[model samples]
Target: MEAAVSCLAEHGWAGSTVAVVAERAGVSRGAAQHHFPTREDLFTAAVEYVAEERSTALRDLFHAGPAARPAVVEALVDLYTGTLFRAALQLWVAASNEEQLRPRVTELEARVGRETHRIAVELLGADESEPGVRETVQGLLDMARGLGLANVLTDDTARRARVVAQWSRIIDTTLA
Candidate 1:
């Protein structure tokens, strides 16, 4: 699964075959096929693996007391800026063109998005009962995703820091 995520993220959909992933995994192609049965299954499971990692990251942030607004903002942004987001982006693009893969990818993305939003809300101590809080959290996630998209082609680090810092302030004021 790690190999699949890495392969898909680095090499993209056409380049990442089950055989390639199996070789990277140090296993036989037969073994991978036995487990995954199809390319969709393999990639779907790979994305699901990444989603679990994201949930774990958010949980760790909560436990480690990154509940401080800046820390939470940075951590949430970090989630999209990393390899997992790249892998998922590749899947999303493939799913866009592939009729067979669209529904599964769409459903998985919805689940991951919802779970991430839930965790982000908790870590940020967001009061969803109040007006606009839910939208605010969703906007933060959407903004993070845009940052991740901006990161794909170039070194968005310096600029991303500025954006993150500004967004942190926005969240602080808006949520305060």
Candidate 2:
């Protein structure tokens, strides 16, 4: 699955075949097919696998103790700037053109989005009961995704950090 994610992240949906992923994982194509009968099965499972891992990682980071709001905000943004996001973006692009992949991708994205929102709310100490508070947190996620899209072409590190820092302040003021 890790190999599949890496393949998708680096080469995208068109280039990331089960055969290539098997080669990357040092396994035979037949063995790869044994686990994932089809390409859709492999790629969907791959993105879902890494998304779960990333969520667990985020929770583990904050499990030791409470982090500052800025740190939490930065971590939230970091979710969109890595391998999982890139791999998932490829799936989204494929899903756009492929009718067979569309429904699965839509469901997967909704599940991932809800889970991420829940994690962000918990980690950021966000209060959803308050009006506009939920949107504030969602805004953070939407902005982070936009930054991720911007990062698809070139390194947006310096600018992304600035945006995250500003977002930290915005959330502190708005969500407070």
Candidate 3:
């Protein structure tokens, strides 16, 4: 799994193969096949593992307290740009090319979106039916995704930091 993560990060979904993963792991192709019968299975496991890691990080940061919300949001923005979003982008590109991976990718996306929505609700203490809360959260998510893509295309730390700051202000003002 660690080898898979490193290979996926290095070569991306299209370039990464079970053979490559096994080679990176210093395991035989037969062993890799024994563990993951199909590429879809491996991709599914990778997505699930990454999602779990991302959810844990966000949960830990957000659950710290109201005093830590800004830091949490900033860290989330950084994460979105650095890892989760990049992996998702690779998955998205792979999903476009491979029909077998589509359902797994979609499932992972929905799980992450649901988790993010839940966290936003908890942070804002906002009702799901509230007028502005959902919209604000959605906007924040959209911005994060966009900023993440931008970060990937250009190593723009200052711009990403600005976006994080703006997102924090929006969340704070809405909650206030």
Candidate 4:
């Protein structure tokens, strides 16, 4: 899946053939086929893998309180900086190029959004009626995604840290 991610990142959907993924994985085409018979299957698996990893990371981030929380939050922000976000962006681009991927990509994105919103609500201790709370959380997610894109394209560490700080402020304000 990592090989497929790298292939997708480098060549996009059209250029990332099973053979190319196999080559990148340093496995035989037959081996790759044994695991993922089709491009759609490979893409689906990759998306699932990334989502699972994010979920695990988020759970770990929230495992501790206060002292470790800030660092965990920063690590969470760093996770989105390039690696996982770039993989997801590649999938989004792939969906544009391949109709077969559109539905799954959209579904995964919605799931992530919903899950993140739930997390934000819990972290903020805010109820549904709270004004601006939902919007702030969603805005933070959007900003995080945008910063991820910028980080990938420009490798700008300062801007990435600024994004994290802005998000941290939202959390702080909401919890206060």
Candidate 5:
């Protein structure tokens, strides 16, 4: 899974072949094939694997007490702007034009999106039943995704930090 994620993050979807993943994993191609019969399976599994890892990390944060709004914002930013999101972006872009991978990617994305929404609500202490709270959570996610994309090709660290700080303030005022 790590190898697959690494491949996707570094090489994008077209370059993340099973053979390449196998080579990176220091495993035989047959072994990789035995576990993942197809590219779609491998990529889907990679997405799930990263999601599980992130979920575990978020679980810890969720139990760490009522996090400050800024802390929660920072955590969400870190989560979305990291390697996992980058690899997922690669898969999303590739799946856009690849008929064979679209269904699996779509399903995986939906599952992840739902789980992410749940986590964001929990982390932000936002009541989804409240008007605007759901949109707030989604807007934060969309902002983080956009920042992640910007970070892909440029040094957006300063800008990201500023945006996160400003957004955190807005969230505190809006959700308070």
Candidate 6:
């Protein structure tokens, strides 16, 4: 699964063939085929694998202590704008053009989105029933996604930091 994620992250969807993943994993093609008979199957499993890993990390963070909202926001930003999001973006683009992969990708995306929202709400200690709290969470996720997209074209470190700082302030004011 790590091999598959690495392939998608580095090569994009079209280039991340099962054979390449097998080679990168140091496993025989037959072995990879035995586990995933189709490209869609392989990529979907990879998506789930990464999501599970991330969700676990988020849960651990939640258990650690009461983190400051800005720290939580920065952590969430790092999570969204990192390798997993890049790999998922590759799959999303490919799935748009590939009919066979669309259903699985779409389903996985929905599940991941829900889990991400839940994690954000918990991390922020924000009451979803409160006015604007849910929207604020959604906004944060959208902002992170947009930043990740911008990161694909160039180094967006300075811009991303500025945006995150501003957004963190907004979140504080909204939740206060």
| Cα-based lDDT for every prediction | 0.92, 0.93, 0.74, 0.71, 0.88, 0.88
lDDT of 1 by residue, 1-176 (tens): 88999899999988989999999999999999999999899998998987798789679757965467998899889988888899999999999999999999999999998899988888899999999999999999999999999999998999999999999999999999
Q: 39-133, model 4: which lDDT tens digit per residue?
A: 88886687668767777766676667633334444655665675557777888877877778899888887887687667655644556677876
In terms of lDDT, model 2 sits at: 0.93
Q: Candidate 4, which segments miss by more than 4 Å at Cα?
A: 66-73, 123-129
Ranking by TM-score: 2, 1, 5, 6, 3, 4
Candidate 6 local distance difference test against the native: 0.88
Q: Residue-wise lDDT of candidate 3 within 1-176, one digit each (tens)?
A: 76676677667987888999899889999999998998777866876687678777767766656645577567656657765567668887788788888878888788878887677667656566767778877777777778888877779788777768877887877855
Q: Per-residue alpha-carbon lDDT of model 2 for 1-176, expressed as tens digits?
A: 99999999999999989999999999999999999999999999999988999999999999988789999999988999988899999999999999999999999999999999999999988889989889888988999899999998999999998888887998888877
Q: Model 2 off-target regions past 4 Å?
A: none
Which is superior by lDDT, 2 or 3?
A: 2
TM-score (all chains, Cα) for each model: 0.97, 0.98, 0.86, 0.81, 0.96, 0.96
Q: Which numbered prediction scores highest in lDDT against the true structure?
A: 2
RMSD of each predicted structure: 1.0, 0.8, 2.1, 2.6, 1.0, 1.0
Candidate 1 minimal-lDDT segment of 10 residues:
57-66
List runs of model 3 lying over 4 Å from the truth: none
Give the Å error, residue 79, model 6: 1.5
Worst 10 residues of 4 by lDDT: 66-75
Better of 3 and 6 by lDDT: 6
Residue 164 of model 2, lDDT score: 85
List, residue by residue over 1-176, the lDDT tens digit for candidate 6: 98898789899987888999999999999999999998888988997899889888887976978888888888888876777888999999998998988899999999999998999999898998988889989989988888889998788889889888988988988898
Candidate 5: tens digits of C-alpha lDDT, residues 1-176: 98899899999997889999999999999999999999889988998899889977986976968889899888887877778988999999998998988898999999988888888889889988889989999999888888889998877899899999999999989998
